[model samples]
Target: MNRELQPLLDEWAREAGVPGASVGILHDGEESLLTTGVSSVDTGQAVEPGTLFMIGSTSKTFTAAAVLALVEDGVLDLDEPVAKYLPELRLADPVARDTITTRHLLTHSAGFLGDVDIASGWGSDALAAAAARFDELPQVFGVGEVFSYSNSGFLLAGRVAEVVSGLGYEDLVRERLLEPLDMTDSWFLPWDVLTRPHAVGHVLRDGKSEVAHDIGLTRSLNPGGGLWSTAADQLRWARFLLTGQAKDAPPLSDATRALWRTPQRAAACPIEQIALGWMVTRHGDAEIVRHGGNVSNLQLSDFITVPAENFAVTVLTNGVGGGVLGPKVVDWCLENLAGLPALEAKPVVPTDPAEYAGSFPTGDLGFEFTVRDGGLWARMVATDGTIETPPAFEVAFVAEDVVARAADTRRPLARFLRDEHGEVSAVEFGLRTAQRERSRLTA
Candidate 1:
């Protein structure tokens, strides 16, 4: 580990309003741990490498692993219609029941809105309540035609795991995934764990740190982003993700492992491509599998693995800023510690005043890109004509070719493809969903 980077990371924790931050790096098959700040501002305890923090959506890798395990046993089929397993499942659109398949669910192509709260409640009943509400959501688009990051889809997928494995969601993960990987300190607990010796979440209120509220327990979306873990345990999980095997771990087949990292669909994200539960990218010559998580004010986490490089990073924060804070730490470590290049800056071209004007529909998400001050700016308008600017990266030229850049990270815009006539022909935002170009509706 680079000793010089430690103080820099602490500076970031303070700037981001995170109470505590921890990072683990695996390089050349060796591991190093680093931590800074206090775990809880209330208790004044220094953050330790072993402190457990909520890992948010990074937990999806575990859920995806369990689903793949059932696939290996023929207990589940990735391509089968989800309705086959949960006969009671339905969407506001009756056709969606038949059209949405397990594959669609895994890839976020089912068109289900990400409305269900994962941080609602804890325990089996909370999971049941989330599962029972499948019929209420409208299909945002035809199944598999567009990608809308859907937490409900994963929640349903988790239900599928329970139905087939005959184990509760948490237990299935604990026994099948966590236990084998020896992630002994990791587990799903009630939201009150936020009040324990665990790190405290924080939000910057009026430029000062204020303890953030635990945004309730995730009852329905637990499968999507609800697990608390330490930097050490996350390192263990990251190692498994890198090697697809752990010592004394009941081994998964190479095929199953490969399936987990395969890109399923382009997510409706700004930066990386989305696989089933993982994000896939190339950091220089290395194949990187990664994911990040956030749950309002409570917790944030990120996990990244470079399989070919034999390197991995796990970051957890006690407060809300931990979400991006963790990734920043990872980016710093990769560039400084692992000798990876800092993310290359994309070329920025001044938009031609005339060419910069147009209204385009990105499936259900629509925005108008306009020329302003010799630069291109975009404003997303809702059906109600309310205008909002999504993170700047949400606006891009040529759809999929656009990239969104943040202070700590960069995400690619969903790409739009055009036909020879210069008419839009297809649209792909994330790796998961692509819609063919169709005739513009005449009003």
Candidate 2:
């Protein structure tokens, strides 16, 4: 372990207004722990490796694994229509229920919207009510057409797990995944574990510290973002993912494991496509599977594993600085401790500076592309050519185009589609949309 990295980690925790932060690294079958900051402003308890934090969407990987276990036991089939298991399931488009399969939900290709509106609270009934709304959502696209991050998709997967296993989603996960893995400190209900000394999330409101409440804990979303876990427990979970060495682990077949890690389709990724609940990318010759979580307040978390490298890293933070702090911390560890090169900040290059500059349309949105500072920047302009309230920027590159950061938290440009001529034909501005040729304008 590099002791010198402690001060740099501490500095980020403080700068991010994190009440607490913990990082776990697994390399060559060994582990390293680092923590800093107080767990809460009120209690003043020092954050430690065992301090629990909301892991948010990273919980989906566990849910997906459990579902795969059932599949291995012949309790379910991935390609079969989801309606076969949950007959009551419905979408505004009746055909979707029949056409979309369990696989679609797992891969987030069902096109369901992310969340359902509900009263802010916790209870079984609230969860049931939210899950019941699945009958009303319109399909945004045909099943398996494109990838869009859909929280409701995973909720439905959880619901299917409940129906097929004859158990609640939380109970099934607890029995099959958590208990077998010995993740005793982790649970779906942090509120129930309130007696334990756990980090209380907070938010800065009007320069006053306010307690952060659980945002989406209804039964429906439990499979999506409801898991709470300590850094130590998360490290255990990370090891399971890195090595697939769970005692009495849910029966995930080798074939199923391969499919889970394989990229399903080219979704709207800024860098790489997504698989099941994991983010898929290549780092040199190794494939990386990772996921990130945000519980909406000052609670953020991320987990990354490189199976080929036998390495994994987890970053959990209690402050909500737009959720970048955790990822940045993880990146730092990968660079410094693991001896990997720092991820190069996206560089702007244009294959053809003139052809790259143009006006393009994305559904109802219009944008103007311009070149500046040896790079490219885009501004969303109204139909009448008025600048949108928040503008977008990008660093143009011939092969790996980089989207510059935007003030309103838009993703930096890191995507491009090539033309038949092998020139940059289309530019993708992060996970949002892609713009193709309009009229080439001079820089």
Candidate 3:
């Protein structure tokens, strides 16, 4: 199988133009690791099995797990309001600030602006400082209104754990989570990662690969999307999730695993529901819980697990093209190794395409939907000049209110949200909500 996979991985990486890539798979009590390309184009160092790559938001699982560990230790409750721990918490909406809980944060339904990026300095107080500025974040919806991903909510959740455990977020995770599971290759700091064989993230410039200007995430957002890990280490993390058994890790109660498996909220197709830190999808009777990660537009990762099949796979890459490569690799592994075929989402054309055409703006990111050629077209806009704008592409409704790329419907691109009078009021994209730009709406 390694012999067959090596050439395929090599071909995929070359086609995707990623500088470095690694894959790990665990199936039926056996495991395999595969690597291709150099860790850095400048250094020309071969990617080793243990070379570290940023796992991005995939670290959210670790954050959620660390909080759960606290729950097992009788230090916290998921259902309790976050204000119980951070008494000084403030937000633009008092009701949401007061009612949001760890569960709400875990499930990405905290209702505040999810895309706010607070860059508190590199210190043990970073998460605390980031959570302190919540008053500036606008309320996108009422509490528990819908499923909009919130990195801010996760940062606050970590702050809750920090307050209760009397330890910093990184220290708590290192001591209670990674160290216990024997995941020694994982690190949360730049200095720590520099000491190991690590991959540098890359971006394409004029069709040429260039090192990304900024590769590290802010210390404040560490709880939301900051962790450097190897493919081998990620497989070990998945094993712990599979059986709740690890080298020195404490046992999670049956109820805790049930919470991890239970469907907390309904989501669009391709994602049947959202579980605790995992996206839950159904293929036949198998429950596929998975998550993908992106780091500053430089690195991309995909992690998947099937508990019933006792199978898991992870792909890590040092280039943005991994966005395309990672999913292709996962789908292949699922069908060949786990006998689970990937589901293809068919387009559902709405009766009126104009109903979804408008400008949805949120924070630094926005989307413009226009009616063209009797179909709906969409493109991403950068409102604050913090991001690069991309060209428009054709998209179609895949569900009653969901819009995805017409070329690939495997993942939802956005969901059109309606108001009390059933008028489109906002759009949920990249798991964040953007209110309609009524003044700039295209008729």
Q: Taking the candidates one at a time, how many backbone clashes does each contain?
A: 31, 11, 0
Q: By summed lDDT, which 10 consecutive residues of candidate 3 come out lowest?
A: 382-391
| Model 3 lDDT per residue over 263-375, tens place | 88985334668888888886657888888787766888999998899899999999978977898888888888899866677767665788788887766567788888788
The candidate with the higher lDDT, 2 or 3, is: 3
| CA error at residue 217 for candidate 1, angstroms | 4.6
Alpha-carbon TM-score of each model against the true structure: 0.82, 0.80, 0.92
User: What is the Cα-based lDDT of residue 238 in candidate 3?
Assistant: 88
Q: Using TM-score, rank the candidates from best to worst.
A: 3, 1, 2
State the lDDT at 148 in candidate 2: 57
The weakest ten consecutive residues by lDDT in model 2 span 382-391
lDDT of 1 by residue, 1-443 (tens): 64876887889887877878888778888888888888777678898876777787787888888998888888998888888888887578888888778778777778866534533355576766677777767666788877666667888899989998899998899888888888887867654455445776666556566665554335566788778788888888877777765756554677788878888765654545578788787777766888877655466777888776778888877775674577678888788767788876455433243333455543334545455544455444332322222333224343233434322124455454556987555444333233342333211
Candidate 2 per-residue C-alpha lDDT over 125-224 given as tens digits, one digit per residue, 9 for 90 to 100: 4445565677667565677876656677888888788889888778888888888888888877756557665676677666545556644345466788
The candidate that achieves the highest lDDT relative to the unseen native structure: 3
Per-candidate Cα RMSD to the true structure, in Å, reads 5.2, 6.0, 2.3
Name model 1 segments beyond 4 Å from true.
118-123, 191-196, 268-272, 352-403, 406-443
Off by over 4 Å in 3: 268-270, 342-354, 371-375, 388-391, 399-401, 410-412, 420-422, 439-443
